[model samples]
Target: MNRTGAALLLVAGAGVIAVTLALWGQPLVSASGGIRLWVNSIWSPETSQQVADWYSVSHLVQGMLLALLLRALPLRRPDTVLLWSAFAIGVGWELAEHTDFVLDRFRATTLYQGYLGDTVLNAVMDYVFMLAGVALARALPVGASLALVAVLELASSLIARDSLTLSTLQVVAPQQAVADWQDAIRPARP
Candidate 1:
């Protein structure tokens, strides 16, 4: 694609993703990624270790892969450009979650709780993963683009929130209370 065409495409894609993220907040889950990706509810040894390990490794792997993708871009090579793009996109999604009428309706009308919304740390990880991906692209399996995507996804399984990590980390709340509160509540019958 021509530079102008590519730029427009990027803009359009970003706009759509931003609008969607602002509308549809994504989910986060890990083998032990807290009760609700809050980071606070994680205490059990296995779960906590798993959460930490997952986030640490996943973020690294994802970041490298993102780096690769960014490298493939036909645009100017600027570090923050890709990272900030990711941040903007993540923040947009957080906002979208609150605005999406359907999601709002589902939570309000249907049975969903603790959808208190997202935070900035989520955006931070977006940048981190973007960096990771970019780094990977710089050096990897020659032509293993698909391989990169798979590794990133696999790493994400550790902390499977909408983005690479959860937003709860952005807002610091003590784990004790989070665990107690989460434990006190029971899930609604599906």
Candidate 2:
């Protein structure tokens, strides 16, 4: 298939996955009192050490794959645009998650115990990471620069959930965890 068709296919696939999960994904707090979490699951900060991967690992690699798909490649401008576009798209999803489309599902069912969209803090970091990715891509060959993402992502994961650089707010009723994460992160980060 052509580039446009392929891009459309990717987008359609993402939408399908999202809707399917939102519609049929298991409830966060099952009727029997068990807990479920997806995307990211660290019950407590102490117990879990962050992994070197998040969605971006796949995302960037997919971008490279996409780079193979298109012919109008600048290698620089496109990378920058792709970086910015990733940021914009992430922000958009965050926004969408907060809106009625996602909220309605949560209210009608317990697919997620608590459903909240990305916060401003997460939004800021997303941009930072996108810039970091763009800068890395500029400084080195594409794959090598992308490798830094794993290191950075891991280092970032080492941080407290509330750190400026490391922002993960997953657990429900996690104010204490958030506080602890905040406390744990501040001294080292400062």
| Candidate number of the best TM-score | 1
Off by over 4 Å in 1: 1-69, 78-81, 98-114, 119-145, 152-190
Residue-pair clashes per candidate: 25, 0
TM-score per prediction, in order, is: 0.36, 0.34
**1-190: candidate 2 lDDT, tens digit per residue:** 3456434544544454344334544222223343322224223321111222243333333333333332146555564455445545544543454566666553342223344432232323333343344444555665665465555555445632322123323323334454555445333322
lDDT per model vs. reference: 0.42, 0.39
Error of 1 at 82 (Å): 2.7
Q: After superposition, how far is residue 182 of candidate 2 from its true place, in Å?
A: 23
Which candidate should be chosen as best, given lDDT against the real structure? 1
